[model samples]
Target chain A: MKGNFYLQGFLTFLKIGLFTIGGGYAMIPLIEREVVERRQWLSKEEFLDLMSLSQMLPGVFAVNFSIYIGHRLRGFRGSLALAAGIVVPSFVIILLIAMFFQAFAGNQVVEAIFKGIRPAVVALIAVPCIQLGRVAHITLATAFFPILVAVIIAIAGVSPVYVIIAVAVGAYCYGRFFKEG
Target chain B: MLFLELFCVFFKIGLFGFGGGYAMLSMIQAEVVTSNHWLTSSQFADIVAISQSTPGPIGINSATYSGYISVVNEGYPAIVGILGSLIATVAVVLPSFLLVLLVLKILNHYREHPLTKTIFAALRPTVVGLLLAAVIVLMTKDNFGSVTDTPWQFCVSVFLFLAAFVGTFFYKVHPIRMIILCGLAGFLLYS
Candidate 1:
């Protein structure tokens, strides 16, 4: 099978990993843009599906994400490539920063830029939540559920793992016993 | 012995690191600083600051830095520190790789089962909520500026936030360009 696309995908993960800051949620938009728009590696719904699965798993959200995308498109080796691509940038960047130590410590210019970025990153993250919400079919009737979820998590400070477990179990039991859609 | 300890610590971190990068911060702090005394709490804070300002996941970034710095802190050479970094990064990522493959195997096996489908479908909205929660969690005074205390910064932040939200959400402005623009705006205004 032609695996050239996986190579490009690996490079894409590398770029995304290098450029995208703030981690976790920040990577979501860039990955969505690349995989869904530029690369067409995954459909919108498929991306959301993979994202939800990634969250449920116990690891760094971005790592789990790359692994899923890699496995889906290019099997195990693909997963490895993508995972390394996402990680190597951070590893190198951190090591370099550590070596210099005093030079870049509390660098004002970098801090200012990130101060500007922190809010934009929020926007960057919020926009996709909305778009993916649509993809997830969160409509009027079911809107309350997601709102409750947001409240439980954001306000009450509940961990997302519990939310995932409860929802999955509820849906599974309901679907199995009641034959509901 | 140090390398072995680093490997074991990071592997455990990876295994239990749920929800996302920020969620793992406390666990990492406990292991590296509180438990192992590999680094000081302030040093760990510096790692966090560096990690936040740089690219990649926080957990992986912390692991890499902790591995190298912990070794160097022990008076090892920088070359040895590099090995420490490599070992920590790999160990942290290893569990995730193995776990993801396991889940994929099961999901692929039950690819056609309705119950699995139901569970998968039910998760979609929850993911939405979780993403929203991420934004909310991040929308602290630290990121957005406190509206009451830091009025000017707060107003400018609100503008930037709206501008970014509108620019991307409505006009289809690419996020990379948006990021650069915001960075420039921030430098010019704040600096």
Candidate 2:
């Protein structure tokens, strides 16, 4: 593989990694711009498919999505390059912050700011609930599963990993045997 | 030894961390704070708050931040603590990287397979459920004060939560902006 394509891939993701705030979901527009609009590396449809697949996979969404895009574009080497690009910014930035954490941790201003952001973060997480529900096509038939899973985790304090696996198995069985065409 | 433990714990976290960072918090807390006793619950809560406001993915930031704090607390040198952070970050990212490779190789062949479709179809709704569960998990007394313990603080926290939700969902305000506004609100009110 040509070195430049991998380098280009790396730089593209590096930009995304640095600029994206509020985590992976926020990177979508920037990613779309770089991959489709600017680079012309992927089509709109392909981007959408990759987006959904990224969400379904475990681990961070941006990294996972970049892996898919990079692999699809240029196989293993491209994937490696993009992975490094996407992660470098976060790694560097967080490492710096962690190093100074002890110094700034007890700052009254910082504490107060975190106090305000804490509840807002809760709200931030909740806003996505509505959007994701729409994407999942939540209907009466599918409604019970989310409610059941939520109850299991929230009330019973069950580990979510188990709930995820059980839901996948339950859905697979229903689709395979129970659901009619 | 601590390095190995950190890598193993985060690798497992990466493997099962469905529904992104918030969803993974309970598991991370269970392992590092509760299971290993690396950090206290209050400290873990602080890490979550910091991770949310900072750049990068929350999962990656949490892994990096927690890894450093875990080692530093263990009396390791600062350089070793940095190594711990790198290991945790890389380990947390590795599973998804490998999974993507396997997926790209296999999913192409079985893209149309009924079993695959069924599994994915079923997973969609449950993923949302898990995200919801993540929200509930974070709404602890750590993030939101208890009604009796801190009634006035609790009211303000609830107000911020509701405002963020309405602003983002209805008005389509960017989350980054909301975070900044909340920070100002915090400084204004608390400081």
Candidate 3:
């Protein structure tokens, strides 16, 4: 049974690594579906908790989530297996593509494909923003803060690091200075 | 000296990088542009544009390009250039792998910690901020020319943005499908 569970963990992460596009938050729902809803490996609460941890950690959220989930299902070995499985496909694909990227670097077809992907990427990131915002129970003020940040970064040409710093500081100040606690 | 520096720097990036490619951007910029002076700010920005549009993680793309340029323009040896980029990429990823293994070993002990839960909650909004930053950078790139000169590209970008927003929020389209559709649209429109 343990062996079976380890395999399941490995395969689950493998599938996520293979299919997930746009990375990070875009992969969240699919992950929730597999680990929480379908496999019953974790409860909704546990899954949400894992998500929070994954975010706090420094790496890609998807990869971190895979690690956390895999660890939950099996032991250290399972975690290793799952993390490896998840990354292998993308690592291999990217490596191979990198080798030949220059060949098609200027190809119009390639350019067009990316052009299309760009907007889709925007949509992909945006949808998650809204969904996750809802899940986080963000108030209108909180919601508007991120959108404002987005626009400033997007249209006003602000640096992202500054935005992150500003938000963190803003949130901290609000919590410290304004909160009635 | 330069070659060794590149190698060590990238190796560190590869080793410590936790949140994957996007997360590595700030660090990479800090090291390469701010600290090392290997690349200028504009050059770093240009590399970012290329990395995003290309196939691979931004880390690898940046490493490869930086490696190539470091050698070609600065007379650094090819091996040093390659080694530098490779090292950073590897360094960034190593921590996550090792940490995951360690966490797995100790998983049962901290499964229900409130501190862990609180940290995760705090991180959710931050991730959103990071993603927002990425979108903002891409949209406002000077190459796109103020939405005036490149009206068509601007329009396309806006349309796709709306499409993706609707698909993910209202229609519930999977991201993979969205990626495919966008790829196809690129071929149809740009080709």
Give the poorly placed runs of model 1, Cα more than 4 Å off.
Answer: A1-86, A94-105, B1-92, B100-104
Off by over 4 Å in 3: A1-56, A65-82, A144-181, B1-89, B98-119, B141-146
The DockQ-based CAPRI class assigned to model 3 is acceptable
- Candidate 2 stretches with Cα past 4 Å from truth are A40-52, A139-144, A179-181, B20-53, B73-77
Q: Give the TM-score comparing model 1 with the true structure, all chains together.
A: 0.63
For model 3 chain A, give the 10-residue run with minimal summed lDDT: A94-103
Error of 1 at B1 (Å): 15
Model 1 DockQ reads: 0.41
For each candidate, the alpha-carbon lDDT, in order, equals 0.79, 0.82, 0.59
**Clash tally, candidates in order:** 0, 0, 27
Q: What is the lDDT of residue A81 in candidate 3?
A: 75
Best by DockQ: 2
lDDT of each residue in A1-181, candidate 2, tens digit only:
4778998999989999899877888889999999999999999999999898887678888889898998899987888899889889989988888788756868999888878888887777677776878887887787787888777876777766677688778877787787654
In model 1, what is the error at residue A1, expressed in angstroms?
Answer: 17
Report the CAPRI category for model 2. Answer: medium
Instruction: Give Cα distance to truth, residue B92, candidate 1, Å.
Output: 5.6
* A-chain TM-score of every model: 0.57, 0.82, 0.61
For candidate 1, what is the lDDT?
0.79
lDDT string for model 3 (A1-181, tens) is: 8768767777776677666555556567877888888989889998987787765556545666777777776756766776666665555554344445434656787767676666665455455555656766778778765566556655565544555456546655555555524
